[model samples]
Target: MQRILDRLLDIFPAADRSFILLRESHSQKLIPVGVKQRHGEQDPNEELALSQSIIKEVFTNKRSILSVDAMDDDRFSQQASIINLSIRSMMCSPLLVGDELLGLIQVETNESEQQFMPEDLQVLTGLSSQVAIAVKNAQLNEEIEAETARRTSLQRYFSPKFVDMLMSGDVTTALSGKTYLGTILFADIIGFTAMSEAMAPADVLAKLNRYLTIIQKLIYENDGNVDKVNGDGIMAFWGVPHSDKSDEANAVYTALQMQRHLWSFNLDLQAENQPPIHMGIGLNTGDFVAGNIGSEDKIEFTLIGDHVNLASRIEHLSGRNQVLISEATWQPIKHLVSAVQLPPFMVKGKSTPITIYSIRGMESHEQNGYIMALPCHILDENGRHLGRGILTDSTPLSNGLCLRLSTHMEIERETVLTLQVETVEYHQPLVCVVKVNSALKGAHGGGSSYTKVVLTLMQEHNEDMIEFLRPGSCVATNYTWNDLKRR
Candidate 1:
């Protein structure tokens, strides 16, 4: 029956038809998506409307209409189109899906004298029902496809719960990456040389995997991405990926969880007659390149820069079950965790001794880490310019989302931002790096602010900067934080 209706509508001469959806007996509505017109003068179309109206009026009367003598009829003579195309006869039928009153269908001709046969209306009614069913199915298919696309996007990066939040229109994670400031946290296991030797090869692999599983979970629970994992060391930057002013809080929370988790694991190892573990963790606040690398065929979403390396160095110096953090990390995370001052020690190949901290506590009470009270600047390729604001504050990073500078600089919208924010890495005289947070924007700043910008290292700050930052420094651009947040 449906197929028959389809063919009949396919041959219907009317240029347009109304497909009705019967939602309720009293609430029938016609969804007007489109219309078809006969390939002739405009007059015939007007006549067609008149003819359709007559057919529809008779539908509720339960009367089949097949009057072929159309144009000369008194009922249609008053219609403006009567003398236009000289349309004569027409037929109309009730379109139904089962017992439901779907709609009405009509066919018309330009010949003024030919009368429609009763059989014509029957054929049209049959075809109209098929049309209604096809339309309904097509609409349903469209809705399904749209829903599938949404699910695919959410599942690609976030957990089911987070994705649900996104579907509900929460765009907190959508903060675009530009240039900003915040803290970076790096962690690594201590003495892999001796630790690996103490166990069988297979045992080492299994143990390492187990450690990573817990570590990754803790980091994710605190809303930070693992960033990058190398051997036993991990470089996790806060204030980006997923962001807000409280990103520092998240980083601190993650560190606290890791500390507790490590403590628990150490106890378990003791009970199992295994050796306890030691670790090094370095936290710094700075800017670095964070993004996607490689060809489209293959790509890695991660952070890369001198800041990333400095974090590893700090981690390398940390000891068993201890978190060795830098002063920069202390700046933002101190409030969230119980940090103890460690005696300053000089790193290899440096005259200055780095002040370190011992991360000893977790945050039972939630709070923010850093504030935007510090003086800030937004620089660009053309030198310094005022950007949006003082870059007053920033969030800690885990999604790899970088912080952004306030709009205060005079930089070109196309210009890249080379920031001079403080970093918490191993501050070597020749090698210093900051984890990046945001992109460059236009603005202006000078005097002490511009001087604070570390153009380079030569025992003293470089008066003329040779160091330049590129757009890849944006955390959001490289890592696809969108996916990470969903995860």
Candidate 2:
């Protein structure tokens, strides 16, 4: 369109400016899409006003118009812009396809001596037909390209086979809404708010995109559909628009792989002297309404129901680097993974408490000690006894040994304390200084208050503690703090 307008301006050297004005379909306002003006002349596109102008006349009459002394011409004399600019002469032709008016092409001169003649109008009318065809073809190509991009974008959130079914009209009947049993997984970057605040905007965007790319790849690898990306979080699911018996296991596998990949991703960050990233994931299984949602013009394939909300709520409850799953999801994959059963907890919009399990890892023979009611003694910084607690669980990771303490006292995060293990595994007293990582307070079913504290052994004592707490080690049972002091 711009090339056509430029050619028109070239052929009419006396003209000061030329423009192609097309009507916006949605707003019905004429906007300039192609414009050319002489040096030192005001841009005709910027000054265009369709109302009561020569261009409007050409459009309304669906014919060519030639005006000599435009400001003095009765058709445009009252227009303030025409009078202000002292537009002396002009020629315009309606761009038409069949009987429909698509737009207008106009050229104007400020000098009365260079007034457009009938011959110039004749030439413009002839060019207008070709220009109309060109413009229509351009618009059609643009629409096709846009539609292709839209489908490509949808592929990011849906399986290719599902997209094919949708595009082929194979699933039109199913799009109206149908109930399907599926597993939903939600995950978000932990501490994203702080991370974004500390980095430059470009860096923040790059880091976030990298993180989401890793997450999306894992989901696709496990055959899960990425339902949506909400800010720093992602909601994905499996078992619709297609389903298989392994949906539950697949979702769990994806969550574990995401966690493992993120750990390696953090290593790259550490080498760059950037803060490591962590995420929390939640999974739930239930029936949900899956179909096209929204207005006809802008509908989307999505899921909706209480289960989706419950999955989001569960994700909200997950701590950094943790994967939490609902009972429904757990039941199908319980034998396939190792998870610690969390105490029943109340969630918003639910009448009863829901049981959740924290995934440890895939099923393996390598056992990290299980959670048990074993006695332990905690000593504060000054060697003063803070309280007694039960050692609920112990897990050995590359960083350090993780100990879960069920204690009555509030253990502050980052607090360093001495723990005396009273279990029967070690003949000698096992004392270690540990740094508190997190402390979660909750009540038991019998109404007893306890704080579940996760602690990591200080660097120097990590190896010693690992050996002392190694799997299947023998130790004395029911030992007390006093017995440790005597030993």
Candidate 3:
């Protein structure tokens, strides 16, 4: 740009000053890109006002102007700058391409003895057209460079596939405010606040990065796009910018694999004499608005809606090293995985409670087994309090059920006991008799030791109760119990 301005000055030697002022696209300010004075130095950063009559006239009319005495010109006679500069003869031409005005070039002669003429205006007019093409090309190159930098920066937070979609211009059209049926997964490091408090900031970041890297790799392997990373937690989703029928199954499998990976990671931590880290995963499947949201200068591609909020809330309810899933997500993949239904708990911003499940593992074959945690009151034949336990799993087809009991009472096989179970379908508790089949230590560790007992339902189990216990049968929907009450 400087070289071009220098040649223009050479072509018009009689002019005492020559400069190229370019209009900024963002601020709409005219900035001096190149400035040359015949005898004095010029400030390249100086800004020129759009109110200057000679420059404004050329810019507004998109034509060349030749004023023999600018001070005497009726249009600029009262203009302060022209009068302060002490009576000038000037010529200016608009840098234009088609209907777009980019800027203007101005040349001034302070000496009244050397005035601009019509032929001088014609020469500058021809040169202004060439300058306009050059300026347009420069702007194009600048925009291309900026776009490349933006894509490179986005790669730090997004997957290569996602960034490619953004660069291809397909996401803008396909995902903008569109509702997509997808699975959202939220994973958070358990006890992160306490862990950070004990460790140095640098160590915390290092360990957090290692954990996030493990999570992000698994998500990508399962065809999920990371929405955002919030400190020690990450939110990712599947089936956006595209869709697959197996999105729900993919999400469940991803959560299972993440747990497996964490087990191996803990082994490494144990070897290094560092405390093992635990994580909680929550997943839900529903419709969400997926798109770029924000203003012109800043935007983000993510999912938003009640679906997303519910998923985060469910994640907060999960326990360490546990993967919890909503009923919506479990319905499709119920047969492929084993989960113990937990008691319905109330969630914030919700009028009624939601049922959640703690995933046990993936079921290998067709089995009639159901895992659940339901409060129950066990009594001896004489109506005496025998124990209180939680029903963990049941297999009515096999005539067997599993319970994690609080009491260590001496109970043997064939021991008759009356069990009262709670139900949402009826006001009365479902009553039945059962014989203890076996007893074993609880598989999970932590608080008081629980005795896991196997029992056989002595009476004919109600088909409705058995059906409700089956996987995919008792999952909750978006409609809360409150909505049911209103109806």
* Local accuracy of candidate 2 as per-residue lDDT tens digits, 1-487: 6677678778998898888888776687777887777766545546544335666577678999888778778878888878876788888888898986778888888887888889988999999888888878888898889778967976777767666766777666343888899999999887899999999999988888888998998898777888888889999999886677899988987887687566556646755678888788999999998888877677777889999999999998776556789999988776656555665768888999998876655532324433222346889899989765545455555434334333345656788888785533235546878888865344221112234566777868655555444533322234332432233
Clashes of 1: 78
Mark the 10 consecutive residues where model 3 has the least summed lDDT. 440-449
Model 2 regions more than 4 Å off: 1-151, 173-175, 364-487
Model 2 TM-score, 2 decimals: 0.47
| Model 1 per-residue lDDT tens digits across residues 414-461 | 234444432112131112122333333442232112211211122133
> What's the lDDT for all of these models?
0.50, 0.73, 0.74
Per-residue lDDT tens digits for candidate 3, residues 1-487, read: 7787678678877788787888999987787788777787765455543337666777777888888888789988789878877647888888898988898888887887888888988988899999999999999999999988988887666667777887887678332588889999999988899999999999999988988888898888777879999999999998887778888877877786686566556645655567878788899899999987876677777789898999999898776556788989887888766555766778887788887876654532233455443556888889898766666566756767776665557776687887776433234565767788864433331233455678887646455445545554443333334532232
Q: What TM-score against the true fold does each predicted structure earn? A: 0.44, 0.47, 0.54
RMSD of each: 21.7, 15.2, 13.6
Backbone clashes counted, model 3: 0
Off by over 4 Å in 3: 1-4, 27-29, 42-51, 65-89, 112-130, 141-183, 190-201, 217-231, 237-250, 260-276, 286-322, 332-487
Candidate 2, residue 22: the lDDT equals 86
What is residue 45's positional error in candidate 3, in angstroms? 10
